[model samples]
Target: MKTTRVAIVIPEGLSGRGGIVRVTAYLTRHIQAHIPDIETHVYRSRYSDNALLKHLTAPFALAAFAVKCATGRIDVAHLNVAPRGSTLRKRLYQAVAKALGLRTVLHLHGSGYDQYYADLPAGRQAGVRAFFARADAVVALGDHWKRFMLTDLRLAPARVVEIPNGVPAALPIARAPNATPAIAFLGEVGHRKGVDVLIDALARLKAEGLAFTATIGGNGDLETARAQAARAGVMDRIVFLGWVDEAGADKVLRAADLLVLPSRAENQPVAILEAMARGLPVVATRIGGIPQQVLDGETGLLVEPDDAAQLAQALAALILSPERRAAYGQAGLRRFEAHFSVTACAERFAELYRSL
Candidate 1:
């Protein structure tokens, strides 16, 4: 049997910093571990310690791409993509692979795609569509994203497939809550993530006499978030820990009771999926592919973005009821196993690869 080879294109900052890098890492790990028939190779398409260095190293990445494609054994190029420069870089790599007669898959990971596509001029939008149109398959995170590709970009529905982001098996529920309820927020602590909203919600909950402790992880606009928390008079109750690796993330997740992220923008939040995998009940906004992962009333609570009062109410409900919290946690774990486990994600990709 001929060996099935695939090139996983990702960035070099994959030392556990961004979401796309982590997803790429997980895909590589599970596919290689389970699918013995297939051979996987990683193509470091983007790498730099800084912005200026990234631009300078672009040609080298392309040269490496040329060499790998010329080797004559690669069957597919799985280009992980986002908006802006990510789209441009992946387009170049995909074009090169297609030019070399390899099957190309465009995996969309841009949460800001709607805005990004809308901001582009009509001609540029068409140009973007043409690039996607050239792909053998366009992978979407969920139905919402699939709709965006089909309706917005006018791509063929059959060409765009939905593959939800998956996490590994659930972590042991390790955090035992003390007198104060322990609430956690993972991902970037920026306005886009609704960190300001979370801060307001904390103040709102505190005023309502619902006490809790929040462990805010990840970076981005953290100083602003701290100021916001301080302004809300809840800074003392919140801890800001920036950019935790896999092991660090597990420790943080294990010690938290509720996983809350009121992001104003999102695609499927890998953080939420990881939280679910840890059997932590989530409180998040009802946006993007969140509804697909978080079954609102069943596994977690959902609120409208920028609505701090509503978010506070939701958090208070979970904080008030230990039984309800445990139930939500158990339900979330079941959902993670049923749909978002790493095995499920790997099998889906393997099937897609075989089809290509």
Candidate 2:
């Protein structure tokens, strides 16, 4: 039996720390473990952060890709793309794949791609559309993104597919009922993630005399976040745990009562899915594909991005009631198992590979 070869293009592959890296690792692992007819390979697009090294290594990466195409090692090119440099790099890969007659799948993962595209010059915008138009299939994280591809990019509706990112389930942690609930914020610790807004909300909660402890895991601008938390006088209540690997994230999610991510933008956060998989509810901003994952009053609470007052109210509601947290957590777990499990996501992609 001949297996379908899929080269998954990612930045730094499994070594990187971000939603795209996590998704790539999970999906490849699942396919390797469960789907015998599909062979997945990781192809790194971006090198290190150093500008000199990135410029030096880029041509080598592209040359390796061309060699793989020339040798017939890969049947499909699965490009995981975000915005800016990612778009430029992937356009070259897509051109190479088209030249070699290999099927290509562009999996869109950009949280702020709309703004990025809008900011581009008309010629660049046309180039981006051409990149999309030439793909064999374009995978969107959710229906919202699918609409963007169809309405905004003017791509053929039949060429677009909606598939959410998924995570493996974590063992649920058992915690004794306490007066103070433990809250968690997982992802980057910067403005884009709205950590400052979270601090403001925490201040409000503290002012309201709400008893709670919070942990923020992930790296990005810790100095500013710490300064803001200290100024808000809520630093004592929150613990910052730099960038966490899969195990660290699992431990954080399992131990926490609920997960909160006030991101200003997102494309279906994997943190929310991971929290849901661990049977923990979420308090997140209603932006990007988040609303698709976090059903407003059901699985978790969703508030407007950067709105401290609304975020504080939502946090207070969950913190003040353990029953609500448990209800929401269980509902979220059910949703995860049904719609966003790693097994399900991998199977969907495997089917897509076979189709191509």
Candidate 3:
């Protein structure tokens, strides 16, 4: 078999702590391990932590990408795209790859891209659609994204593919209801992630005298969340662990009884997938690609976004019943193994690459 070379254009590459970085890293690792005919290369397009340096070095990066294509080094340009700056950067790459006659795949990872597109001017919106319509294939994280690509972008159904984010399998924690159930909130701690809503819900649970201890892991507006927790009078119940790396995330997942991510906007979060892989039930908002992963009452619970009352009710249900938590966790693990495992995701990507 002729080995296929894939240029994975990503943000900040594997060193960044963002979800897209983590997802791309997982796919690369799984592809290297399971598929021998695919050669993966990482190209960092965004220096997220440093803006001025990123702008200064943009041309050099583009030159490097063009050189790779000109030299026949990349068989497929697998571009991981998001909203805002990612869209701008990827448009250049798309044009370069198409001009060079390289097969291109746009892997959409944007959490708020729909809103971003809506906010764009009419001409720019047409340009964005043109970008997708020209791609050899577009990978959507879920059915919601698929609909956007088909109806909003008006791409042919054959050009769009649905592939969920995946995580390595983790040993399911042997969980028993403790004197106080330990809740875990993983992801950025800010309004977009609904940390404020979570704090409010925790306060509600506290007022009702439900016993639970919670931890918020990941880096984002910590002071704002702290203020919310303090004002809610639930400061004593929640612990903020600033920014958690991979090892720290594993520790948080292992100890958590249920994972909560009530984001007002999202497109399939890797944190939820990681929790499900570890046999932890999820309690997340019913938006974006969350419904696909969290099966409401079966695998876990799904509450309305920004609705602290509904979030509180769902959290209370799981915190009080160990049997229900265990059942949900087990079901989640089964779902993860069946659809969202690293191996499964890698196989799907390999198939996509081969087809293209």
For 1-356, candidate 3 gives per-residue lDDT tens digits of: 98999999987778877798888888999898889999999987755457788777776787888998899889999999999888889999989999998899999998988889989999999999998888999999999999988888999999999999988988646666567799999999888999999999999999999999999998999998898888889989999999988779999988889999999999999999999988899999999999999998999999999899999999999999999999999999999999899888899999999988
- In model 2, how large is the Cα lDDT of residue 193? 92
lDDT tens digits, residue span 46-138, model 2: 666466787677777888888988798899999988998888899999999989989999999989888888898999889899899999999
TM-scores for all candidates? 0.95, 0.97, 0.97
Error of 2 at 252 (Å): 0.4
Q: Where does the lowest 10-residue lDDT sum fall in candidate 1? A: 170-179
What's model 3's lDDT at 184? 98
Q: Quick one: ranking by lDDT, best first?
A: 3, 2, 1
Q: List the RMSD of every prediction in angstroms.
A: 1.6, 1.3, 1.3
Candidate 1 residue lDDT tens string, 5-33: 99878766355367777777787788878
- Highest lDDT against the true fold, candidate: 3
lDDT of each: 0.86, 0.90, 0.90
Record all residue pairs in model 1 with backbone atoms less than 3 Å apart, i.e. clashing: none
Per TM-score, what order, best first?
A: 2, 3, 1
Stretches of model 3 off by over 4 angstroms after superposition: none
What is the alpha-carbon RMSD of candidate 3 to the true structure? Answer: 1.3
- The positional error of residue 25 in candidate 1, measured at the CA in angstroms, is 1.6
